[model samples]
Target: MGEAAENLNYDCNYNMFLAKIMLSNLSRPEDRQKAVKWMKKLATCNRSIEEMKLRNDFMYYLVVNIQQGELQPPFTDNPPTSPLPNIANLLPGGIAEVETNEMGEPSSTQQTKKPMLYENSPDGGAFLAAQPVPRCGAFCYLAVVAREPKHD
Candidate 1:
């Protein structure tokens, strides 16, 4: 087989191995619930194949080894927070979610509001729960800097 075909075969085998480990661990109720959750998340995601593979590998390790503090969730930097006044009710309908960042503080009694569809990012691309579409954006700001740049 050619190099690409060989690599594809290897990738398929690795993914199948990961899936086997994950499925075998699902005999427990908690593990089964978690597996279902991650499967749903993986299904809805628009991440690249490499990213999905990495997550599956982590999930496989999490299932087989069950390490402490290994898979710290990236979302919910919200400190053990009280819910926004009416937001809890809206959650069932998927209409509202809490907004949090360094600048904006969430208040327990804050009025209900629709979460912004998108927000500013450090890269100015997309919000936290989103996979940033690799964009070839303008680099005009770089022109103002006086530093010499390196080419890899």
Candidate 2:
């Protein structure tokens, strides 16, 4: 029993040592490729995912505009509100409805439907998990981290 315990300890130490070496060698092309492939496999096509990405991009644009002081706040008779223009009406699918006041001022009320992409998929996360990241652009190297192993 004592000898068996020592062997198990040695094996555990060896595996840990190997893992440390692997982590240290993460900058190697092979290691990077392995990580990239896994990432690509996990990150590929899905409508809800695409919508989320687009929403994040739009949010980034909004943040940039705000930081640059390009965004304007709405004027009010007694107080002030966000100067950002009402752009929900410009989106597609007729999913959003906007209402304006008699003074032609946006009231900041909109009825938005859940995006169809999100509604159709009950297990969107699992669906995304099962997809393979597409390689379509010069930066597809970034997506390689999400790809499934392709044996030839």
TM accuracy, model 2: 0.18
Candidate 1 deviates by what RMSD? 14.4
lDDT of 1 at 46: 26
Candidate 1 pairs with clashing backbones? none
lDDT of 2 by residue, 114-133 (tens): 55654666664465556676
Which 10 consecutive positions of candidate 2 have the poorest summed lDDT? 72-81
Q: Can you write out model 1's per-residue Cα lDDT over 38-146, one digit (the tens) per residue?
A: 5444333224455444444433443443222222231112211321122232223332345545555665565764444323334433333464433234322222436
In candidate 1, what residue range of length 10 has the lowest lDDT sum?
75-84
Q: Local error of candidate 1 at 16, Å? A: 5.2
**TM-score, per-candidate, Cα-based:** 0.26, 0.18
TM-score of 1: 0.26
Off by over 4 Å in 2: 1-47, 72-152
Per-residue lDDT of 91 in model 1? 28
